[model samples]
Target chain A: MSPSRRHSDPQPTLATVAERAGVSRQTVSNALNNPELLREDTLAKVRAVIAELGYTPNRAARQLRTRSSHMIGLRFEEAQEGTSNATMDRFVHTLVEATARTGHHIVLFAGDPDDPLDGYDELLRATAVDAFVITDTYAGTPAADLLSRVGAPYVTFGRPWDDPSARHPWVDVAGAHGARLATEHLLEVGHARVAWLGWEAASRIGEDRRAGWEAAMAAAGTSTDGLGVRITDNVDAARMAAHELLEDPTVTAFACASDTLGIGVLHALAERGLRPGVDVGVVGFDDSLGAQVTWPGLTSVRQPLEQVAIEIVDLLHTVLSHKTVTEPARMLEPTLVVRRSTLRDSAR
Target chain B: MSPSRRHSDPQPTLATVAERAGVSRQTVSNALNNPELLREDTLAKVRAVIAELGYTPNRAARQLRTRSSHMIGLRFEEAQEGTSNATMDRFVHTLVEATARTGHHIVLFAGDPDDPLDGYDELLRATAVDAFVITDTYAGTPAADLLSRVGAPYVTFGRPWDDPSARHPWVDVAGAHGARLATEHLLEVGHARVAWLGWEAASRIGEDRRAGWEAAMAAAGTSTDGLGVRITDNVDAARMAAHELLEDPTVTAFACASDTLGIGVLHALAERGLRPGVDVGVVGFDDSLGAQVTWPGLTSVRQPLEQVAIEIVDLLHTVLSHKTVTEPARMLEPTLVVRRSTLRDSAR
Candidate 1:
């Protein structure tokens, strides 16, 4: 036979296999769908017919009938000018593991350049992913507006400033709660004069952390004025701030907002002939890799990054699959990791 | 008008526009291809007619006539079990930037797991991408078999071991050259007896580095038999090896294959009241982020990760576009970064 003629042979469809196996169409469908329900003989006969006639289920046809791609988009917003924070990298790694378990793949896309107005419109228009997971929200970001306009399923890593109604699913560690825990640890240890070294006040996370510090001081009946609060853009600035803070002997301890700031604080203290945990106690937030490698290991608050990643993936899957999500907003508590940085001499 | 009737309208094609604008088909194509060639009046007239008739080019029909997808696939082996390395992360970041400049997007995929024997069969059967880029090669890997079976145009991040004559395009740093430079640096600094601390010897890069170390020692009139060569599965083993090497005062310096191993040596030496630069010297390969953060920062070799990333993308693009690649295999040289770890004193 000619190659074209041989290729034109009639292949058996599901109905043909059902007829040949001496069963109804519903019975054949049930055998394929729920094999445990059918008798062993019946299943064997159907499967034999299927193999003999080369009857293959058309996955493309099924996908067309059910408009589901089973793929999700992860929109990573690059740091405007500097490097991405370590927390974001950890989140991406965790998300990769979580998605692999469900037989789904993630496609990464970059967001629009940092602009107050345009936002993620360009990214949304170019990609046709079933869902989105956005990380690291900033104030005045157009993500919320674009999410509304696109009307696609999405989960955010942090709560937006304007929306307090919990309309969308979000997963965030209690930033204020963690900061309060750090401050209380220092205060309970017989340190009356404590300072706060943190990031700039532009970020929502920084503001929340600072608020927690203020609240803890107020609860102790201490004056908020002249409480050594040094804020800077990044680690280098924090180092300089720490240098200036050390000039004052009254500030006995410091509660830093992040681990990078804490490491910088330790380096600065060492430069001025002051030893951490001896002359002054230090506490930091976010128990990252930096916490382990610092000179006197950092005592900080540990945010559950893996748990957040798992819950975010679960939420996205539920939304995409039309399952009801019982909790719209989930807040995880951060725990304290005590190390040499905060160990008092008497306790040691 | 009904949608069906609207589709039946006699739309003006490119040929009609070319005729109406009194230009050749090539000229009209160039007007669309390179708009700067045509005068303002002529380009405006052509564009007006094209928009009025709602003419849209059928990219699919054009692709059928000329087979091209303008897409590339990036396949990676399972990530090694540990924290992500800085070199690989930086390489991926640079690859994304390089590919974006050429208006092509990279689709990242993992090898198939069900049929381990034919891992890339699923990807090969589905011809969605025009070319491929494979990273992180190992001996007897399914990727090597897949590349050979499919005969697809591709580029790799590392060289293959099984078949040196495979004639595949690749971009990698000169491993032996970097090792030789590192060994000579120690010798020039007046360190006579040096030991080698490394991981598995089965690795191609590992073997090359060992050869370089041996050659350097032999050329310096030093016996290679008594040289301390420690192979370990973990950093703890490396630390123990360092402790043993320090027992003999003859071994004055050490050469490590990775920065992590080098850090372990520093820690091991500190326990014995021997500082890195004062009592002994140390050198590490791959100037990763860990190298800079360590106390008395590590001195190591720095690979051009960004350059390799850009070159891989460029080679893949050229192969897919049927353009000639001037060089099939490219090797980049590594630079030495001197830090406090290898310096004789803090003053230096």
Candidate 2:
């Protein structure tokens, strides 16, 4: 599989066609596969450009020559038991849509959760998933090493946290930026002494998110002493930690690293008979289903997952066509969604 | 892509190897590709069987000759906006795991949500997804019809409700059986007038589930008149309907067709200052994240999604290997997960 990628990179055929047609690679694909999906004029324009470029619409011909599968392998990180903070489903949905237009499909498989590289090599050999798009940064480091060593074409949806020198194309959400927005939103709502409930120090993502709350508190001239708690990302553990934090009269709000942690704070508030937004404001990250449907709609930081998928596809164009690496990594900002949890009203 | 499936079906070489080797088809593939994952004795045994069966482990060679992709196409139904009743994610996780072991993968792409076949033809030609496994029974009719007409190999995860004459392999859960369990549980807990909150009459799955609650009520000899309300599956709509249902003091429990509706009932109860379990018992279908993580965990029907994935894979073996189909269609039962929503003492 890796050897197939080592062939002399093809000329910028699809990109040139797309640019000349003033449309996306996906649109060009749609013109070929589902022309009915496009307007008559758009379809005509795309077909004209495709014919002028001599871009072969037949993937079968390309496969015969280069063994190209036109499929990107993604190792699915299964949803954690009983948790709604899993973002893979949302990301995959958009990723599928983003790639489908370009006549590509995402090949989904489960690697041993305990071992990320467990079945990766076999998948490529057996399923012909010769290329990949990695999601879990922690596991992705090794995947990058293996793919790079083997010379396979691939991209990452997360930054290489442990490896500083790796130059593979990547995109990541600005975790600190999202957490800062969450913390700032809480402060704006008149909540003082907002505490941070986050994952343990070992997690780069957790620490990255925690930095935002710390920076915001420092900027606001608020005391951080005895106000922050770091634990494993679990509802029960975070809930117990939040219960202890709530014993202090001054802690009036929380900015959590993840929705699972945020839910724990809500659980603690429920136990203590404290209304979520009125008594103590709460904000979660990822804007997951739990945040959306929780009793007092939980305010959260929403990542631009759709945009992330689009960027990955665009990056694939560069990597596969061997185009100039204009941007090796992209850090997209996150937006805050305000709801009853941070609105100081509408709570039960 | 459809033309590729017209080749005469291959012999059951893999099945013979697996059975003689005292292993599964997955183990045979593992012996060929990722032998390190298996034990030394097991690998040796599988290799022996492969030799005796004269199986070709070289997919590259096979692909070159047959133009086979070994990729099963699936149209992703995106998660409903702000709803937790969506069950596609869980099903996909298991499907991917099940297929990976046998050197197969799911080619996930978004179809035009409006038209199930909107991008079907294009995806087949562009992605080389020569086979399929359909999930949405309603949209599946045309897909199955098209594939059968084209002589493509395919299986369905849902029953062919509108096409009983269809001979395609399928696996479906007993919706009525699941709903009956929910209603009877409420009855056993001293609730006589348990109501049914369900989808409108047009949905076959909805109607199937409704019959269970109806039968359970009749079996218990409880009057069900005015106790069943059908509407579109939405949280706010279901919540509004639940509010109206709550007006009748006799309606002490509700069995909903989906977790989204059950969450709605929870919202209505919160608004009326009524407790979920003590004042009103609520049960939802699918045991979705909403059911698991709601304020009072929702007691709901739990589909054997993992088992369904395994069944689909097993059916795939029979369909693709040209083996005699023992059971053209399989039906599995669902269980209930009891939680705080139905347990009176666990609520906040």
Candidate 3:
């Protein structure tokens, strides 16, 4: 029972491929890892022999030799258990796509709701994951300190707004700019006294989005007082909040923090027998799939998921390869997608 | 530059813990792997020493010694890129949770839509994933053949309907039973002529869902002739198809193969000013998160995703641990959740 044996016959090894190819073990290694160093004829012969032997570059043995696990760790954090969130799913999808293009594969760890960095220690101890890609950053995220203490190479998707001087590699979307675009678009569409609907939770990203709206309002010389900044994460809660906000007949539009909140705004408007885009304008963020299906089709700011995913992987890869990435905090812009939800007098 | 070094400090090993605990390396191994073999005091002492020394078990060394990667491979197959599927996300969530509890982690491979099993050989050769959890099974999935040829263990989420003689571990939802439940509920609600909206794709699960509707309709002593089974995977296509299906005023209800098709049916109904659960009743399968958000709230059959995920991990773990899982081809029943969409003249 050899380490690589399946049942009766042992799995092929580098030694087997070398022997079959009439080459030295070092030659076989070079053929796989540093093929350019070998002659064309020798490389071709080794590859064919390796293929014939069905030889797989043993990752365990390679890890021992190179001190790299070649595995990327990702934490799947659910805000609410058993509840589906589209943004997180999309992020995961893009991250998987990005990592797959590289040779590295993802090893997902379930983030402990209580500890936040729940599975980090266990993953670091039990698996050979080379680096981690952390998302859902908030104030006092224990993941950063823990990974830093362990000297684990990692990159975060959210900017570390809590610690401005932190030197860790991170990539974030320009959510504030996206919000500004949404607010300005609503204002341009002849909407005065636009309301801002945001999450009740105190998060850096949430603050950024709010700031964008505030800045846009201020620039327009509009009084920011009583702008109807209602806070709610649930659609129904947001809808109820929206109902209260809409009591002021002058508040003609809503700049929602997310598509979910926007959906709530739409529900509230429907309850009042008001049509979106025509009677009351609404704009959402994160252009999630739900945005497209929402009755009037919500106007939203699309997060550049693919680009952000690529940056996360590239930053982590650079750190793992011992190469310096100059821009540790890479901020990318988000695009605004205008749909019928924001158009004035739009058809159903 | 040792294999497990972090910056200037080398990570602690079993020998370090053993020396600190005043015991043999075997004692430390027993403390971690075979803890039950050790005396309580001895086990506690080794564990404390290991923790104090920050000693983590070297998985690569363990892999070389035990020949087990301790990884479960799962393919993230995308039917269409950027299309968020809640069922798959929930499945991944549950799988991660289940495996994390068992000290086994999942290694996700980006499924190739072109070849289906494009990354199979790559994963088998590059990583030490113990077994695969195969899902999204079609009539001729290349994954099964690829894994079998390589002597890899796998358990599928779909029934191996293409080959009944195939003796592979698999667990499938009784989709037909779910369809039966939905159909019977529709009939119970006084809908005489029910239509089935199914995917045009040739899938075992899809067929099972349609068959359930057919079977239920037959058992009711009603002729299923011209039952208006319109098939389309696209939402707009289904909507257009639904328009044609609804031309016959005799059709009083629709049992959809998926929530997407159900959504399309809802859209078509809305366009015609037909209130669901009042003028026409509608029921969807998979009871995805979308079902809850759809207007009037769609009545749908909930696929036991959590249970199914647990079963997948359990069956694969059983096979990997050399334990036989009795009733490998397990068929679990689905539950129908009645919502406003199914209630006649229901209000939001």
Candidate 4:
């Protein structure tokens, strides 16, 4: 009676497939797109019927009509420039897990922050992704120019340094706020001379974290002029710096920018016969797996990586759909996980 | 004279942009793709030329005619389901770093093992990629079916579970071999009551690792009748199991499937007032960040993830270019890294 039934071999449409498989259209779609969510037997039956009827959904036509590729593009600014093996591993894992929820996939494009605008142009012309999510943007990067030129819907993992007024949607952790919280925690516990072990001051994140430490010191009416602050990029440098700072004796607490540097600092402290909580309190950022696995586990600010990832995806989707976003930039609060690294046993 | 230079306003190609920017074509490409490799002024000039010309190269046409999309697809079997966040992150970071070396990008796709057939149709039907790399394939996954159907060249991270004769280009660390090596190390140290802490025994990797452990134990003339083996999926479960096994006073050494589980075992030993190297020797697989960060650092068999990733990409490139692979499947040797977890300072 239908166009498919009239043919010698009737091809099953969504309705026919649903009817034949004894499931709803939505169920059939779910079985095809996200089979993990469906029962094995139900999925098997639906697949068998679809294969038996040689039913092929016209994806191209559907994509064109809806303008939704069911695909997202992820642009990694750090990935191209050679990030540490650990950082890379965590990012990929988080990205895959986040996108799996939407039954969508990701296309990764890594570009140098120092490159001209051409890198953006190349990516734009290469794939037909519905939306884009950019990570780790630096000052005066070509990504900014490309993002503005293409006018493609996109979101960033970090704030752009060049333009605070840039109308791009972004999700970033309140680094300064978290650092201040860490500083305050140490002050409340009678640690007066709190030092700071951070990455290069040139990094925006480092600067923000430093600002928070200074603000906390100012609010507590403590003189920070004599407080130790060591800024370095390498773990070896941080270790050396920590050893030097510990020799001062007045430096009783340290707020580190990352867990990696914090670990190195811990090792250095241990070599000098200094206990973490009893001798010197330490607080690190990112609450990475290293934070938990370290001896006297690191008390650090946990960045909601999963939540940030989800929010970035959601923002990009909203922009792609031409919906109005309530906020151009959103900053999520970091939760300080009180682990053994900074807390005395009595405090816990 | 040329099609691009016909107008008074010449459209910038890589060559034109290079000439204007006073650099080589490769430099221009590098500047665009990898700015970190270049100086600041050169990058700025390249951007100026690109902006002035408003030049956009047709990537689709170039990809079609040259058979070079400059893009590769990364297929993961359980990436959408079963992998840990840490493992996933490392793989993604490794893949990104490995491919960036050749100026290629990665598109990630998750395949359903249950279907073992139509799961990869979406990736196949969409944009044409230069090559594909498959990771974490189960026994009955859709990878083989997709490979056969698409006719595109692909490399697998792990070997085929069934059909040892299956001639697919694969790059995997010899897990079983690593396990055997670990077991042999324990035996060489006069440890007779060595136990195995394994992942899910249902997996091909787990089975292979177990076989290696058995082979090594048997070679040392030890009976497998009462071997203490704990198989689990959760880290806490492995820790609890390790605690129970230690209570028996027979399990002297343990070789775990992963560093995560090994760390858990170490934590359990510590909880019972027993030091790992002094009371119970331990070895782990994957030699991940978890292994290094843990106290009395974990002794692990390193899988050479970077080497494997690079080799897989190289193999996929060759296969895509229609080159005959001299060796269809290559097995890499896993190296044992001895740390405080395995041997006391005096023992070493």
Whole-model lDDT values for every prediction? 0.66, 0.81, 0.80, 0.69
lDDT digits (tens) for residues B57-108 of candidate 3: 8888888778788888888754342222467777788889988888788888
Between candidates 2 and 4, the one scoring higher on DockQ is 2
Q: Per-residue CA lDDT of candidate 1, range A104-136, in tens?
A: 555555433555333233333323345777775
Q: What TM-score does candidate 4 get on C-alpha atoms?
A: 0.71
Model 4 interface root-mean-square deviation: 7.6
Q: What is the TM-score of chain B in candidate 4?
A: 0.78
Model 2, A69-140: lDDT tens digits are 677888887777667765878899999999877767788878777776765665544436557998888533
> What does candidate 1's lDDT look like per residue over B1-348, in tens digits?
011112124534568777877787666776676889988988888777665544544323333234443445665333232221345555655666677676554555554444333324333333334566777664434565565555667788877666766677888888777777788888888799888886676777777777778888889989867564657534456678888888888898888877767767776775575767667888888875545555556778888877987898888877776778778788899888887777886564
True contacts kept of each: 0.01, 0.44, 0.42, 0.23
Interface RMSD of 1: 8.2
DockQ of each: 0.14, 0.28, 0.45, 0.17
Highest TM-score against the true fold, candidate: 3
Q: What lDDT does model 4 reach?
A: 0.69
Candidate 1 residue-wise lDDT at B248: 84
| Worst 10 contiguous positions by lDDT, candidate 3 chain B | B77-86
Winner of 2 and 3 under DockQ: 3
Show the colliding residue pairs in model 3.
none
Q: Flag the better candidate by lDDT, 1 or 2.
A: 2
Deviation (Å) of B316 in candidate 2: 1.3
| Model 4 chain B worst lDDT window (10 residues) | B76-85
| DockQ pick, better of 1 and 4 | 4
Candidate 4 on B1-348: residue-level lDDT in tens? 012222234335678777877889878777766889888988888777766655555454444345466667776433221112255455655677678777777877654435544335545444345667777565543566456544656788888877666677988889999999888877766678888888676778888888899999888888776564656644566678888787778788888877767877876875676767767888888776667656656788877777887788778767876789988788898999887787844453
TM-score for each candidate, following the candidate numbering = 0.75, 0.84, 0.93, 0.71
The B-chain TM-score of model 1 reads 0.79
Model 3 chain A is weakest, by summed lDDT over 10 consecutive residues, at: A1-10
